[model samples]
Each structure stands twice: as structure tokens, then as C-alpha cells.
Target: MDKSAQTRRNRRQSATFFTLGLIFIVGLVVMLSNVYQLDGLTDTVHDRHAIRQNTRLRSLQQFQAAGGRGVVGEARTRSVCIFARDGPAILHVKAVFERLGYDIRATKDDDWDVLWSLKSPYVAFGERLSKLKPHQKVNHWPGLGSVTSKSDLATSKLLSAPVGYRLPKETDAFRAATKANPDKMWVVKSGTHRGVRVRKQVDNVLKIRHDANLFIQEFISNPFLIDGRKFDIGVYTVITSIDPLRVYTYEEEILLRFCSLPYHPFDEAEVNKYVVTADYTPTWEIPSLVEAYNNFQYSHKQALNLHLGRQGHNPKPMWQAISDSIREVMHAKEDGIREIVRKRFSHQNFFELVRFDFIIDEKLKVYLLEVNMSPNLSSGHFAPNKWLYEQIVYNTLKLVGLASATAAHPADVSKDERDMLVSLRDIQVASDRCASAECDDNCKPDICQLCQLCRTPYFTDSVKAAFLEHVNRGNYRRVIPKPLEEQPSTVDVSKAINSTQNNHLMTMWFRGKCEHDKTWCT
Candidate 1:
């Protein structure tokens, strides 16, 4: 080979090597730019995700602050405090604690996990449900509500009770009634219609009013009869929440309290029979079969059925009528109830027991005669044999949780499933709730047996919105005020209460008042 040919070959090889090196450098720069763009996109997405998580966490924080039990786990604390003294209502609740193995005491202890307020309000952290020694109100009527006082009657006006007037704290009831209506057959009661005395004479009204709260209402003469006997029924309701007053009436567990005497109004001998009470026993010296049947130690339902069928009227539909009345009365006072309870505690964990006494007329129309706050829950009245008040204790005990559920969000739980409020009947679905949890020896049982339930979501956007949403769900019936729509003739608030007017107001008392236009709670 010649020298010139060798030099040309070297040049060609160098040129080819230079071209390859430039291409490699250009490709490396393009790859680095792509990598930088990818990182920038990832950071944008991560920052947005972080913002969303923080927003959700803030929302959850607000919900937990308002009386909501957030993120309640399966295990419940076994200890509780009985924030009540020795009484039928307190004693009955204590019995339930004893049976359930909950460490219950007359006074609350720091180590105790749950606070049983009985017929009272819930005490918050560092406070007590009952302080010092046990205190008992001789008269549960003051706060529990009464049928005998003017203020109470006004509050109960929402209940749409029979047209009645109160004698004030100690005003002559008989005189007042006689003064109100000289010709009407008004029944005067010290506290309730049961303890009432009906007379055409207008004497001694002042003494009765001075003795206690007095009320005078034209007597419900046409009461449903069981073989011509007058009787009243007892209903049990539980208050799970107060601010958003959530009440549940026991449909299955109820009692029928029958009057010992037959329904004979004018006869002085049978007038006592016209009055029904739990402790009343017939003058067994002339004890009739109904009295014998009542005294013979019968099952609650049996006694009720006998009393109900003695007159041969189906108790089922009659019961539905009674339920409507009870619900109507409670619905009327829901806001007031919330206000009353909120004055003490707004925590959703609060609960209470209320007893309602009702009497039904011959037309199957029910009248809400009276209400008992922390009513007589003596086992002897219907216990060991009757399940009316006992079940109220049972279900309430079953629902109240001792463990404080820590409120958590995606920031804490990393996108966990939402917590839920469940009913005892729906406890069978416990497995689904604990699917993510370590369902070991202890956790599985309570996952079903004990779950908190309320009207609103355990989680919500704002505390106020969530809390208000809670009360709205407490509606016994969503009586949406539709002024523009057709109105039901039976639900007139302004009209004087008459048997012909269905004897009830289906909406809140202030609603449906046609001071001008005949409609109103939109």
C-alpha cells in the first residue's frame, strides 16, 4: 500500500468515530430532559394528593369534635359507673349492669370506662354523671315534664293533648275547672289523670292545687273498653341523642296496664275503677274474675291480652293508634327536648329512659294522658314477668360504648374505610366491618354486639353541619311543611282540640298555624 492511501484511511476512521461520539452525546441530553420532565409531573401529582388528604383530615377533625364517636373499634370497655341513686329506675338499670358483667357502682370512679346517667344527662370528661353522694329528686316531675302545670301544658300543647288547663304550681284546680267550664264534666288530677278526681261540685280545688301540681281537663268519657273496663297502656322510649334528639320507641316491647274497675263514670262506687294505676288492686272483698285474673300471677302479655280481649277488641290496630299518639307527642317536643338536653351536654354519647302513659277511646283514637320522666321501673310492676322497661335498659346498655374511639383520617389511617354507626339488629354484619382489622380472639365478639348508631354520619365535612344533620334525622315522620300543597284537615293547630278534629296535631305546635295562611317546618 502507498503512504497516501494509508493517510486517507486514517482520516475516514477518525471522521466516523467523531460522528458516533456526537450522536451519543445528543441522545444522552434528550434522555436526561425526558427524565427531568417525568420527575416534575410526579411531584405535581404528589403535591395535589397531599393537599386533598389534608383537606379531608381537617374536615374529619371538625366532625370528631362535635359529639360523635369516631373510629370506634370492636373491643368495648367492661367497666361502667351508675350515675344514679336507689330507685326503681336506677335499680332496674343497675340490675342490667350486674347481669352484663359491667363493673357498676353507685358512684363513678376514675377507672370506670362508661357513665350511666340513668334518666339524667351525660357528664363530660373530668366531670361526673353524679357527684359526691347519690341524690334523688323526690319529684321527678319538675324536669321530666308534667301534665298538671300551666307551663308544662303549654309545652305539652305541642302534644295536642285533650283541651285542658293547668292550675299553676298551687292554684285551685277544681275552682279553675269550674270557673273555666261550669257545665263540662271536667276531671281534676293532682299530677296525672290517673290520680284524678271528677266531681260536679266545685269544692276543695284550692287544697288539691296547693298540695301538688294540678290539672283540669274535660274527662275522656268514651275510652276503649275491655269488657267495659277502663285501662291505660305504658310505652317505653329511649333517647340516644339530645342535641339532635334521637328517640326510639320500643314497638315490640310494650305493656298494657289495665284498670281494676270497670268504666262506669257517674257511679261513685266504680269511679275509682275508672282510674288506672300500677299498684291499684281491686277491693278483692268483691273481687271479680278480671281482678282474680290480674291477681293470679299472669305473664305480662297474658294479662294484657286478657284485659284487652275481655272486651273483645283487637289489640293490634289499637296498638298502632296508640303508637301514633305517642310519636305525635314526642315529635312535638323534639326541639324542646334537644334544647333541654343540650343545656346539660351536647355529646352524642348521652342517653335517657322515658315512659309514656296513654289511654285510648272507643273510636280506637289514643290520647296521650301523661309522661313519666324516669318513670317507675319496679320489676314487680311488670318485671321478671314483663319486658317493657327491662328491654329499654338492655338495648341502651348494649349500645353505649365505654371505649373512646380515636378520630382518624387518611392522614392517620392512610385511606382506611369509613367508620359506621350500626344497629343491634344489624350486628350480624360485623365481619364486614372488621375485614381489614386483625379479627383475633377478643375483637370479633364486640364487632357485632356493640356498635354506635346515630342519625348522622360518624364522619362529616363540618361539625355544625354534621351536628344539625343529626337532629334532622331524628324525625319520627318527615313532616315537611308544604304550604303550597294540599293540607290534611286533621292537622289543624289553630282549631280548638275536639274528638271530631282527630284530637291531635301531626306537626310541631307552632307549625300548621294558619294565623293568616293555613300551613307552616318547610
Candidate 2:
């Protein structure tokens, strides 16, 4: 009896020990598997970061040695011809060459003597260059032209009217209208036949044409604003090649021009001059003040809204919404224009710099004001401010194969250069700033400019890794779960039927019980 009991006890103890050991081994393997998974994830993330770092390094190198050219030692020689209207815009172009150490001379025949056509100092031709117009011959060399006849080309007419168009000249009739309505805008015009002058005004501007037989558009009022201040959107697209006229880069810079309301205040002397001077218009007080008066008398409600507010009511404060709306519309139109070139003229590249003008209303609707093909870049309003223009010029040179490959990378860029880059990027972002709207506002260049300025190789690899790391540390990963695959559940008709029957029975029983025994006391 003792041996049998001993053997049974030993077997029970052995069974218990074996089961416990197996359980412990299973738990250990599970824990090891989890550890392996976590390590693998971390390693994968690190590898991704390394690859991104390598890519960014490569890009930086490419940017520095733009077009694979090393540093530019001196300006080179190149030949180019440009057609443009003689105006303030041309003066900016002249300044670009003078700064680059090039000789710029305006020729009687409407040609500019540019020093370095190939990485040399150059002049921005001050002629009206336009897309090939209807009923005009395609300009093959020196670019498009309005001068068809050899004699016309020989004359200043060709250069004076490159688009074969001219705006109206000032006249007595126009002066009278202007005198009658000094605040209101007026139009002037001129025409010619067989080189004979014939000028007159038509009721409709659309029907009128200048001496070059081309219509001249009147400058419209820009009513767009920012924080109730007047502003314009400058689409700075770079033309890397004019012969091919490829647009290499596209940027939108905002020019927020601060103008006081039509009637905030006027200097005492200025007001006295307007009041006492004979040259003063019927009511030459302050434009803003006059506008305020008109608004109050005609639209009392609007005047009240513009005058009464915590900010002391800005009657004609900057209109940011309108400014953006105008840019959005122009962006779409420019896309169409670019497409026409790509499809019609075989230009597939983007412009290096292009600036469009727009005005917006209180409702945020944009209106096309005018197109500034070449904006001013004078000393005060220099297009390339300190570091800002360096990027433009550097990027332009890079695109044209004039700089080193890594010209885009700003790491090696001088501190001053980097500051300008930062400002340019900041401008883009600031332009996209809106009180309430999607970031995709016409000022999307803001994001691109910032990315370039920060030298973050975009959101490709390193960016994603950094983001994930932050998310994990911040517990964001727990909130944002990985996507799961959708799986269809098999239907159990019998179960469903039974469940329905059970519910029906419960309801019927409850009703019957209520009818038979009100309180179920019995």
C-alpha cells in the first residue's frame, strides 16, 4: 500500500512540474517575439533615415554645382535680343546688368548692347515681347516681332511698337475729362495710317487701338488688400531660356502696398494747398476722406460698417481676401496660357519669374487688374533684395547650366545669402497667410520657399522619420492606428432567425402579462 501511494504522489508532482515548465517556456517565447518585432521596427526606421540623409546630401551637391558647373570665375560672352516697352520696368532690367558688371546701351533701333550673353553681364531688353498673336508671322530669330516690313524694321517704329501696338497719347479731350473728374480715371488714344497721325476716342475701350493697330488696356483700380491694406500678388517665374523661352521656376511674391483710407488725414499744408490752390480739382481734399463722404451719403450702411469697430472701423482698410482671390484666378489663367505655349508653341518648361496683378472685393472674389510681364526691380524696389535676388540669380544660373551642381543647397551658401533665401521663403508663406482658408491659397510658393530655405529634403524620407519619432514620443501613434484590411463576416441565417423569434416572443409575453396581471402580484 505504501509503494502504490508513493508512486501516485510522484506522478502527480511530476505532472504539475512539467505543466508549469511548459507554461513558462511558452510565455518566454512570446516575450522574445515581441522584443524582436520592436527591434526590427526601430532598425527599419533608422535605415530609412540613412537613405534620406544620403539623398539630401546628393541634392545639396547638385544644387551647389548647378548645371554641374563649378564656381563662375568671370562673366562670359553671349548674344541676345529683346523687345520691350520703354518704361520703368526697363530701368530695372538695366540695373540688373549694371550690377552684374555688364555694358548696357539702348540703341536707336531698339536693341540693347548686353555684355555677357553666356554667363556674362547682360541687359533685360526693354521691348514688348508677347505670345505669337493671331494674323502675325512667327518670329524665328531674336524672338517674336511686330515689324513685318523690312522698312518698318529699319525704322524705330518696329522697336517702338514691338507688338505692333501702342497706347493712346494724352489729348485735350482726355485732359478735359480728367479735369472734370480728377479722382476718376480717363483713357487716351492715338492711331496712324501710311505713317499719318489719326487719333480719336471711342466710347468703348475694347474697340480702340493704338498707332501700332493694337489695343492698349487701361490700368484699372486695385481694390484688394491685406489687413485692410492694398496689396498685389507678384508671380515671380524665371525664364531660364528665352530662345527656347523655357520657364524653369515659378514663385509668387506678394507686394503689400500700404495706403491709408481715401480720407484718414492730410497734412495741413497739403490740405491748404488743395483748398486754396487754383489747380485743385472741384473737391481735392483727401481722396480717402472724399470717398468716406461719398460712401456715407450714398451707402450709409456700408459707411457705418467701415467706421464703427474695435479697430476704429477701417473704411477702406487692406483687403487680403480680395488679393488672394485675384491671384487664384490669375494662377488658373496663367496655367492655361502656359498650356497654350506647351501645346501650341512647344514650350514645356515653366517660367523662372512671372508676376500677375489682381484686386479682390470684400466677398473674397478676385478681379484681374493688369499683367506686369516684367515688374520693376529698381534700387529701392530691387527685385533681388540682398539675399533674395542671389537665390533667383543663382537658381537662374543653375537652370541655365551656369552654376555648380549643388547650387540649390543653401548649407554652403554664405550667411547673407541664406538670409535672403529665408526672406524670400518667408514672403511666400506670409503671402499665403489668410484669416480663414485652405493653405493651398495661391501663395503655395510660401511652403516651397520655406522648404528650400530650411534645406529640408522635402517630406520624403528624413522628414517622415522625424515625424514618426515625434508621434511616438508624443503618443500620437496610439491615437493614429495603422489601417486594417476589411473582412466580410459570414451571415448566419439560422442564428439571425432564432434571435428575431426570441425578441418577438419576449415582446408578446410582456404584453400578455401586462393585460392579465397589471402588477403581477398574483
Candidate 3:
């Protein structure tokens, strides 16, 4: 009775042990792979941001698990009143923000500490905008004429697109609009489309300006191309404070958007897409377009490498160039932006996201395409060939000092306390001080020469200092690059951030059982 029974029992135990061991090993491998990013064979969507977000999430969880409190006691946290605009990006923003532990609401009360808005900074100053256009305003700003305090950017090695007609005596918008540069191309942007390049002809130019709202700009013809596709570098810039005008650009997530079609200067058919879009490729012409998209496209990092080889420059200089171009444009319209911010958005305090588009010529020179007011933060931006909207927004929130859930409670935040944070009235007091002559953001020797403050030496130095302060910063891995702390600690959960509309369901449920006899699951 013993031998045969004992052998059968032993075999059963062995099988059980083998199955348990295999499961343990599989689990261990999965954990290691996720933590170490060992999926090198294929980089999927999650690799772009999930890995980093998960790391941050785990760190936060571990901090709370370790008994550390976040933003507790008298430290106090803040809640932002977000007035988001309509679109897919904002939809993503609302979803991301709702998950966080804050009082996410829509309000214009004076007590709100911080305001995140999608409304144009100029909307409140529409009367002003109507009275004078962008070019018109730039031209008339005092001290912008030849007798100025600021030095020109071109004097330095920094490449910049020439801004025209700002000096009032020489200003004639019509003449400026009609005259063609060597590029022989003009770009007109009115309400919504990115922009359209027009040939140099007075009739064509007048027809465009007839819209009244149109901004006529010179379009660059000699652009650096990759695989014959026209592309631009999209930089995500954040303005934490406008009083001193703080702006930062993310270096790591610099997005490169390429055109769907090959770069052909004379091809009128491809104009709209070429006016600007890198995320989508044309699907027309059947097999050829599809085949072109498949073969021509590559990730931003890959494109960067290709561009680097083509330009023989490092990431540092390229980013520095891009940042310089942004500053130059800002210098040209400083007062206009400040007025828009002060009059319309003049809250006690707020934050803003500015998306700057730039194109490079075959000479590796950087040109500012435009500063997008309502930046579309869809999956494609700030990181080419990757979905990183979550990461981008997360980083922005961290930079803005939105404390974590552990810091404060929703009931704790009130409209009364927020009124004390810095308001436009407060800034106006200092505004004169900035203009009184002696403040500069972080101006350097190289940047000072490029400072427009020289042109308007009589104008406020505080603002120009901010513009000139960010020069010669060799490209950074990320514009606002800061890796997570080495060890776990309380992460500010006020860390990251929108929305609305609705639909309804009709009617009544009749309790009749069992036509199909189907039941719901647990």
C-alpha cells in the first residue's frame, strides 16, 4: 500500500512547487523591467511619460507611507482658479486636475490665490487692441526709435528675424507690409489658421490686410529641412510671474513638428499645412502619401540627432539659440504684453503658458515663427513622436509652486486670503520702480549687448532685464530640467493641474426580468 501511493503524492507536490516558483520568477521579472525601463526592444507610448509619472507617484506614495506630512501646519498650500478654453488639450487638463486633491472650481472672486486662464491676455483690453494693431503698438511705444538704450541682437552671434517699422518716423504699415525682403515671401495670420505665405505683390498684400485683423509677417524661404520635410521646433515656455516677467522653456520636451509634404516653395496646394503643422501628414493621393508618411517620419530625438549632424552643433547651442529668438520677440512687444496682462488678466496673481514656434534655416539660424496665445497641448506637442501632455502639465504645475494635498485642505483656501497675494495694483506700484531705472532680471555681458533696453534706456529696465537675462545658457537637457529627488520625500501634490458641457439620458426603467436571462458581474 505504501510505495505506489507515496510516489504519486511526491509527484503532485513537485508539480505544485514548480508552478509556484515559475509565477514568482515572472512577477520579479515584470517589476524589474518596469522600474529599469528594460523594454529597449520597442519603445511604446508609456515609455514616454508613464515611467516618469509612475516613478513620481510611487515616490509620493512612499513618502506618505513613511509618515511624512506634505505642506502641513502653517505652511499653507494654494488652489488655482482655472478658466480653461475649449478643446481636447483642455479636456485632458481638466481630467488631470480633477484627480488631484484640490478645490478645482471656476470663479472670478478676488480671493482666489492663482488664476490659470485660456482667455487671451488681451481680451480684456480689446478696445486697446482695436485701437492699435500689434505692429502699430510696437512702433509707437516710447523710446523704441533709433535713439534707444538697448543693443540689437544681430550684433552678437545670435540669429534673429528682423522686426520692422517700430521706429515711428520710419513707420508706414502699408509700405512695410508691401515691401518684400530677400525671402520674397509674406505671411499673413488673422483669426485662426496658422498662416499663409504670399508672393511679393502689392495687390496680394492689400487683399490680405483688408481683413483688418491680419498680422503681416515676412516668411523665411531658406529653412533647414529634414528629409525634405519642413519642420519647426516647438518650445513650451512658462510664465510663473508677470510682474518681473519670469519665463522658462522646457529643454527636454522640446517638440519638433514636421510637415506632411516635401518642402516645395511654389506649391500652392500645400500652403495651409505648410503654414504650420508637424503632427499630421497628408493622407490624400492614396498609396504615395501613406508610403511617404511611413518612411519619412521619425521621432524628435532621432530628428534632433539628424539635425545635429546636419548643423554640426550641440543641443546646448541649439536651445540657446531658440531661447534667444524668443527673448528678441518679447523685447519688441514688451509693453503690449504687459498691458494685456495688467488690464484684462490683472488678478492678484496668475501663471501663463506660452508656446513659441521657431524654424531653422539651412544656415542653422533660428527664426521666431510666432508666439501662440492659446497653445494646443495635445498628445503630439513638446515631444515629437510621443504622448506627453500629462508630463508637460505636471512639470508646469510643479514649477508654479502649487503645493500638495498634504499641505492644505480645500476648506482652508478662501477668497479673502488670496486678495493679499501680489495684484496688478501691487505690481503697478513697483512697475514705476522697474521703469525708474535700475533693475535687470539676470542680465549677462553677452545678453546685455542684445538687450533692447538700450533702445529704450528711458523705459523700465526691470522688464528688459528679464528678457536679456536668459542668454548664453548652453542648451539644457530640458528647458526646466530637474530630475526627481534621489530619495523619497513629501511631493507637492498641489503639484499639477481645468472645464465643461453636458448631455442627458432619457427615461424610465421597467422592471421586467429574464428575456435573455443575463446577469451583471461582481
Clashing pairs in 1: 224-361, 227-311
Candidate 1, superposed: residue stretches over 4 Å from native: 1-77, 84-92, 106-111, 117-155, 168-183, 192-195, 202-212, 265-271, 281-317, 340-344, 381-388, 399-522
* Residue lDDT tens for model 1, 1-522: 999999999999999999999999999999999999999989999999999888877766655554334443324335556666667656766776667666664352455545555443432333333331111111111133432233365335554466665655434553554677776665676654455676555454434543345566656777776556676667766554333333455544455555766666546345556777656542222233345445775544455655557666666665555545544554455555545544543344344556667777876666776676666666665444335455666654443332113333212322222233322232222334444344432333333222222112321211222223223332121222222233342334333222121112112211322332342222
The full ranking of all candidates by TM-score, starting with the best, is 1, 3, 2
Q: Which parts of model 2 are misplaced by more than 4 Å?
A: 1-210, 213-222, 225-231, 239-252, 257-352, 380-384, 398-402, 406-522
The lDDT per prediction is 0.48, 0.33, 0.45
Q: Going through the candidates in order, what is the number of backbone clashes in each?
A: 2, 52, 20
Error of 1 at 283 (Å): 17
Judged by TM-score, which candidate is best?
Answer: 1
Residue 191 Cα positional deviation in candidate 2, in Å, after optimal superposition: 13
Question: What does candidate 2's lDDT look like per residue over 186-222, in tens digits?
Answer: 2222222122211223344324544544333222233
Query: Residue 361 lDDT in model 3?
Result: 79
1 or 2, which is superior by TM-score? Answer: 1
Minimal lDDT window, size 10, model 1:
133-142
Candidate RMSDs in order:
18.0, 27.7, 25.0
Q: Looking at model 2, which ten-residue stretch has the lowest summed lDDT?
A: 475-484
